[model samples]
Target: MKLTVLVDNNTYIDQYYAGEPAVSYYIEIDDLKILFDTGYSHIFIKNAVSMGIDLNAVTHIVLSHGHNDHSRGLKYLREQYALPNARLVAHPLCFRPKSYENEYIGAPFSLEEINRLFCYQPAEAPVFLSENCIFLGQIPELYSFEKRKAIGTTIIDGAEREDLCLDDSALVCRTDQGLFIVTGCSHSGICSITDHARKVCQDQRITGIIGGFHLFDTDSKLEETIRFLSDLSPDMLYPCHCVSLKAKAQMLKYMDIEEVGVGLTIQL
Candidate 1:
């Protein structure tokens, strides 16, 4: 499996690509071309074009969550390519209206609008995309240190309540070495996500992890995360997007956290 960073919060010094406070990854597993989490705008599309990735050929568009930073680009993708055949995969609640501090933070497109453009697959269970790739749905918050946190409020059946981001998910790829977990925001705790992936895939060895860890501070959570990751001992780490510099610095003290950017690519 191969993964390309189509859109991220940073770009390499010499790489000529747009950077945004978002996440989007173009993954090629087996014969399938999968797009994981469209970024904030057309920036993902523009970066894809720069990398010579054909968005029209994407077979699957998987959303990590309902957050705008991750799903907003779906609108631009539909307007630009209109990939009628690509499957749109996400949790059932991913389209529900969500607000953070009185500002919209949910997916820009409604369920009705999404159905018109692509084959909608609302998965509450793990869905296999290819022989090696699988989408981990509704990660369980099993770890005590990684406590469940609410990002904002979400409307369900016309009632507004705290959004613990039940719609958040991740993608896992089984390679010869181990599993490579791809995530966005990780509203579901990163360790919890990995643990769920291990349970679902029945594999404990993780080769690498890429995308937003949603770690902004070097607090207890970050320390616990470091401990967990240290125990897991993954071959590579590319923490970006919502991860802050201080958290990265803390991670670097214990593990080799690789650099991530818009034009970066990884093969496993």
Candidate 2:
């Protein structure tokens, strides 16, 4: 399996490009091609094309959550490419007329916006791309400390949402070597994602982790996360997107890590 990062929150200082937002990643695994999230805009498409990826060839678009930065490029992508049959997999609430509120200026996408963007396909559920690849829809929260972090709180119709991370989901792949997990923001909590992967794959070790860890904080939850990962011991850690520099530094201390960003490719 090979993974290519098309967009991310931080580009290597030498690989800088203007207008791209905090994070995004495009991954290629065996014969399957997947875009984890579309970045904050159409920039992902531009970056992918510049790097020799043809959007028309993508077979699946797995959204990790519903925040604009993660799902915003959908409209542009479908307009620019020909994924007429590509399966878009995500949690049922991904189109929950939501926004990110507490962490930053949360911009909840209006239902009208979703309709205009995806041409209005109702939120999809667990979708299997291949025997070895699967999308875990509506991940069952299974950890005490790993509760969903409060982000993107929005008023849907009348009620205020405190845990509106309904758009969160995780993807798992059972490669010949072991299991590989690709997440978007990990808003549902990283530990929960890994648990779901293990449960679904039945005793497969998580060999690699990629995409936004949602650890962009001064008081970020790295210490506990490190302790948790120490038990799982994934072979490699590829931190990108909302992961903090401090978290990356700490991850290196615990396990093998590969820094990733736009235009970079890795053969796993």
Candidate 3:
């Protein structure tokens, strides 16, 4: 499997790619071309083009969650690089109205609009995009310290309720060494997502993990996360996006974190 960072919060000094406070990865596994998250705008598309990646060739689009930073680019994709045959995968509730601090943070397009753009595959269970790549649907919060906390609110059946980020998910790539987990802002808790990926893939060895851990503050949760990841001992860790400098500093104390930026690529 080969993965390319199309959009990230940071850009390499000489890479010359556009950077945004968002996340998007272009992954190629076997004959499948998968796009994980879309970032906040059409910037991902522009970066992919610069990298010689053809967005129209994407076979599947997997959304990590319903947050604006992750799903907003779908609108640009639909408007410009329309892939009518591509499969759009996400949790059922990912399209529900989401708000943070009384401001809209959910997907810009409605479910009805999305259905017209791609072959919608709303999954509540693990869905395989390829023989080795699987979408971990609705991660289970198994860790005592990594409990789900309300990020905002979402409307369900016309009733507003705490948005526990039930839609938060991750993409697991089963490599020869172990699983390579890719995530968006891990609102479901990075440990919970990794644990769920292990359970779903039946592989205890995690080779590496890339993408936002959502550890922006130094708290018990961040401390617990550092502890959990230390024990897991993945070969490489790329914590970016929603992760703050303080959190990264604490994480660096426990594990060797690889630098992540736009134009970065990894092979497994």
By TM-score, how accurate is candidate 2?
0.85
Winner on lDDT (2 vs 3): 3
Relative to the true structure, how large is the alpha-carbon lDDT of every model?
0.92, 0.72, 0.92
lDDT per residue as tens, model 3, 1-268: 8999999999999779999999999999878899999999999999999999989899999999999999999889888876877899999999999999999999988888777767999998999888899999988888887788898899998899999999999999999989999999888889999988988888899999999998878999999999999999999899999999999999899889988999999998
lDDT measured at residue 145 in model 2 versus the true structure, 0 to 100: 63
Clash count per candidate: 0, 9, 0
Q: Following a full C-alpha superposition, what root-mean-square deviation does model 2 have from the true structure?
A: 3.1
- Better model by TM-score: candidate 1 vs candidate 2: 1
Models, CA RMSD each:
0.8, 3.1, 0.9
Per-residue alpha-carbon lDDT of model 1 for 1-268, expressed as tens digits?
9999999988899889999999999999998899999999999999999889999899999999999999999889988997778999999999999999999999998888877767999999999888789999888888887777888899988899999899999999999999999999888899999999998999888999998999998899999999999999999988999999999999999989999998898987
Residues 90-179, candidate 2, lDDT per residue (tens digit)? 666676655453454332455566455443334345566777787878777787766766664655657877655866888887776688
Q: Rank the candidates by TM-score, best first.
A: 1, 3, 2
lDDT of 3 at 74: 88
Candidate 1: which stretches are off by over 4 Å?
Answer: none
Kindly give the stretch of ten consecutive residues in candidate 3 with the minimal lDDT sum: 109-118
Error of 1 at 121 (Å): 0.3
